[model samples]
Target: MKQSPAPSLPSAEAALPRLPDRRQSVQSAQTGMVVLKGLANIGGNAGLTALAAHVGESPAKVHRYLVSLMQEGLVDQDPATQRYFLGPELIRIGLAAMRQAEPIRHAEPALIRLRESLEVTCFVAVMGNRGPTIMRIEEPGLPVTVNVRAGSVMSMLWSATGRVFLGLLDEASVRQMAESELAAATDDMRALLPSPDPIGTLQREVRAACCASVRDTYLRGISAVAAPVFDFTGRVCAVITALGASGGFDPSVDGRIAIAVCREAHATSLKLGCVGPPPAAG
Candidate 1:
């Protein structure tokens, strides 16, 4: 039988295992970068789970890496919530890195312009464990207003700004965060929520509006509109929100204001040399 035709050689393509698409491989890498950068910016244990899901990894594996990071002092744990945060090493790293980040430096002026344009209370907030921490606030020109000051911490599950920030995060991550906070919160705190489904529903709405602008009604008589702000890598770095008296500013107006805020934020990002996908136009 001519030794089975000398045993035909396998083709080069057949010799190799099926490889993942190059585009998919690139996306996987990018996803990992996004998760890492998000964790660095947000600085919380909940972020690890989010990052893991974003990269299609298990939380335990992510936790192992985080633990190693902690051992090296690149991360720390919060005593109150036992959540992890960027440690002293990261503080040093961030200080050095931020030197090249002009957007963060110019955050105040951009926020000021957006506020002035909208003539509503505007806030520039950064992500945190509790929620978005108000880095700066521009009170509206109006006489009567809601006075939320800088440094005030808003609930990630409630306030408009916080919701916008949460919207930037992935669904599984948001759900994980909400559940963690809900578990930590008092019974009275849980009671304040609209319903058990609000967390998941709100998170879905927020993520769906990632690149697009979105608006929401918070307190009975208070409404605010917001847009997600991205950094050079197109990660949701911060959120700029416009708040107004529910009576004076109609919900429709809030939507318009969100469009304007997103535009201004995009301009600012451009000025700061941030390269990323432009915010969705209204």
Candidate 2:
């Protein structure tokens, strides 16, 4: 009829994809994430009133959700102080989310211990796309001014974390990391390599000893020692680094800080399901 009414144009609403039903969405899950985010922002245990303020929820509402989260083992409240902190179930879930997520949840306790014992700024590093990058840090009351923090990329050939990555990563990965940095280096910087074997030898020793370090190389008066955290595949998935002043921090294998880092790394690796101690070396 009338050439089908001149072929009616498609409505703009019709061109758009249909959204899922709002009623089907779980609002509670979104609320849960908000509560978790609020807890993280608070950085530790908080009283009911403080937590409510942080999450912008009423105390009664926060308490109800906290009770539910506690039942699910996602949040915990201290019986003595009535303060809230994250719970163990969240740790398990976080660890399960990534094969190499030791540093995200499992390594914090060890990092805290190291920081307290060594009075240094200890951090966890992982191989980010750019290079070895800091993922977490725990420092003493008076932290030093090294400038690197979570997400800071260390030097592939110069920084302790980068050296650990260079030392422990597979050959192909090591080459890729180095080349990525080299490709970005200026001509003058490229000419500064000490020799052809400058980094190769260190890689060998680092792999053999299962750790690496760089002192007063990147930032004068700053030093770092990094020990490998192996995964079930025995690959160095991450590293624990303790950075401090030049003289106060030792990169030596047997030194106090090195031993602490190596110990924590090994323990975390074991927790991640790597074989224990290589059968005691016979």
Candidate 3:
């Protein structure tokens, strides 16, 4: 009898066991996670019946998972209400995840994607000692002509990137920087700002839009859209910006470029362990 043909490379690889496959998952552990997620989804404090309904499991089975999770310290129950809540161990794990989050590192890949997909210049800016400063820049094949580069300090009152930091952060120092910029600006430059309460207006508009867009404000002939990248603490740690020549760029807050920028910023914020809604382009 002819021997069976040797296994192909793909077949050989497939024969090896891989982790994270459903077949490799411990059933008990998967059930426990489902129960935990159900608890979290029901506002993190729910009765057995609600959790059971949420997970589409019998109360008895979900209870068994809950008991295992309790032993693992992943869940807890209130003595008075007999309701399940996310346990101290979950908080500890969350804190650990937050501690490892780095804003710039998480945002760099997003910038590159935005540059490639949208064909616009993109950058990540962090609030530096001087002001909002560019940390990384990603330019398209034909780069837009702008004065800013990596490490360049943006004008807190002028640039879309700087305005995003100013709008989200409630820091006295940041406000002071904006004030100083406003105070030192010439009549021509000051005219570019919103009338009758520029800072207040800027903050309101940015907060409402969940991002900032500028047309010929910071750099003449250059338009930009910027969105905030938040940390787990909900603080705006950095801003992601995309800019292009005004002739070709749409600077509307609700335009495609703004939406893409906000989506990337929201994704970066998620990688930084931030728990919040996506930036809505208003």
What TM-scores do the predictions have? 0.54, 0.60, 0.85
Q: What is the lDDT of candidate 2?
A: 0.79
Model 1 TM-score, all chains together? 0.54
| Model 1 poorest 10 in a row by lDDT | 209-218
Model 3 CA deviation exceeding 4 Å by range: 1-27, 41-43, 53-56
lDDT of 1 by residue, 91-132 (tens): 787667656665555667867786677677777887776667
Which of the two candidates, 1 or 3, achieves a greater TM-score against the reference? 3
* Alpha-carbon RMSD to native, per candidate: 17.0, 18.6, 7.8
Superposition error at 271 for model 2 (Å): 0.7
lDDT (10s digit) by residue, model 3, range 22-137: 65467767777888877876778999998999999999999988988888898999999999899999989978887779888899899989999999999999999999999999
Clashing pairs in 2: none
For residues 156-211, what per-residue lDDT tens digits would candidate 2 score against the true structure? 87777787788668768677778777678776655544456656776776777777
lDDT of 1: 0.65
